[model samples]
Target: MSDLRTRPTTKRPPTGDLAAEGRRRRASIAAFYTVLIVVAIIYIYPFVIQAGTSFKTDGDSTYNPLNPFPSLFTLDAYATLADVDFPLWFRNSVIVTAFVTVGRVLLCSAAGYALSRLHFVGRKFLLAAILAVMAVPGVVLLIPKFLILNQLGMYNTFSAMIIPLLWDATGIFIMKQYFDTIPPAVEEAARIDGAGVVRRFWSIMLPMAGPALVTLTVFAFQGSWNEFTHFIVARSSAETNTLTTGVAALTTGQFGSGNRYPLKLAAALIMTIPVALVYFVFQRKLVRGQGGGAVKG
Candidate 1:
């Protein structure tokens, strides 16, 4: 007869120096967190100051420039913003950003899919040209964009501001890289079932590109929202003024005079809200999106 239960084995005590190892590991962890906290403070301090300054009086902001607290807490800055054409500038910015984001996403995705799947003449050359455009400095295009906008009668118009930004080389590059990672057989199966190129792309391929699309959407939104350089050259009318251009004018005393730190900071603070919300919402997906184009094989 066999014993039903096995004998319990004696557990050995841990060998020497484990306590020392544990203390060292704890110390290392402490040091790592200490550095992280310091860096976070460094990055976050300015934003805190920005928010605080928005509530400050101009005199407080200037005399105690580094002070984050208001000498006299007030809503005058925000009140001033409310009285002015700030809402108009905000609306114009929203309009341009909406158009640019949606247009860039659709156009860039289509261009990327075509470059990835369709075998057409000059495709490689076109991709190379896009790369070359990316290589070209943005400052170099300012004058040309202005001139072309003027010639095309799109100057001082929303079309001028958004059309130029709707399809950038970066978006195309991102989409193409992501699409390259997708297996060809997926599209081929769609084709075998009587799906056409447009149908397959719109129905299957575009939807499969969720990560890239999210990345593109966020990028487009932020870029268009924060765009200053192009807006400067694209339009001169106050009616077409976006937040970036409008804020610049406000800073230069076009709207108001004298330091106006609180007012300026208030505008900046408001401008930051939309981009921050978008980034926070899609941040996790933004991280995952980077992996779409990172295929090893």
Candidate 2:
């Protein structure tokens, strides 16, 4: 017992060294937090400035571009927006976005389900065509889209705006991938119960796709809401101006001559609210949708 006890207690680490190691660990943690905070501030600073500048006067915004706080706060920008066709633009955007979202969800899901489950003559070729379409840059299609709308006499109408955005290749691809992850047994069991293709898909499969549906809805809403170029080419009437085009006109001196930075910023801020709310509300579902395919029974 004495020999065991006298074995120098495994030469315990020096108290000073332990204290220094703890200090080093704490310093590393503090440094990591400092870097994260700095990066967050860097990324968030512009939005903070934009919000503050929206409340500033024209002179204040012009002179104090970098400063977020306004020396003379005013509601002049929002007041000015009130006089413009802002409400009309907002209404147009809401109508277009609603129809586009619903159409995309239904159509993309149907196409995805067909691609995933149904075997057809040109299924492989059709999927390949869709992939090719996805590869093509959107800007390259602007002229073609415009020409098609003009040919169909859809120009300067809500149909032009809403119909063109109804089907998204990416959304279809996402749904197809998600459906592929589901077990065939689920659908087969429904078929054994005398369910038809439409009934099985609508009742048995669609409900299980909640995460993917939410994700698709969010994308469709945000894409249609913020879409600018398509709306630009699809319609030209002020009566059908979406928030993007209308706000863009504001920035280009559509309302007045001078810089109106505050008005522009306020319009941008207001336009961003719906998208932000959507992301916050459905963020969890979006994450789940992305990872759902990886989960197995």
Candidate with best TM-score: 1
Each prediction's number of clashing residue pairs: 0, 0
Tens digits of per-residue lDDT for model 2 on 220-289?
9999999999998998878999999998877776665787889989998899889999999989877765
Q: TM-scores across all candidates?
A: 0.91, 0.89
Question: Candidate 2 at residue 103, lDDT?
Answer: 98
Clashes of 2: 0
Q: Estimate candidate 1's alpha-carbon lDDT, on a 0 to 1 scale.
A: 0.89
Model 1 misplaced stretches (Cα beyond 4 Å): 1-16, 254-257, 290-297
lDDT of 2 at 89: 94
Compared with the true structure, the alpha-carbon lDDT of candidate 2 equals 0.89
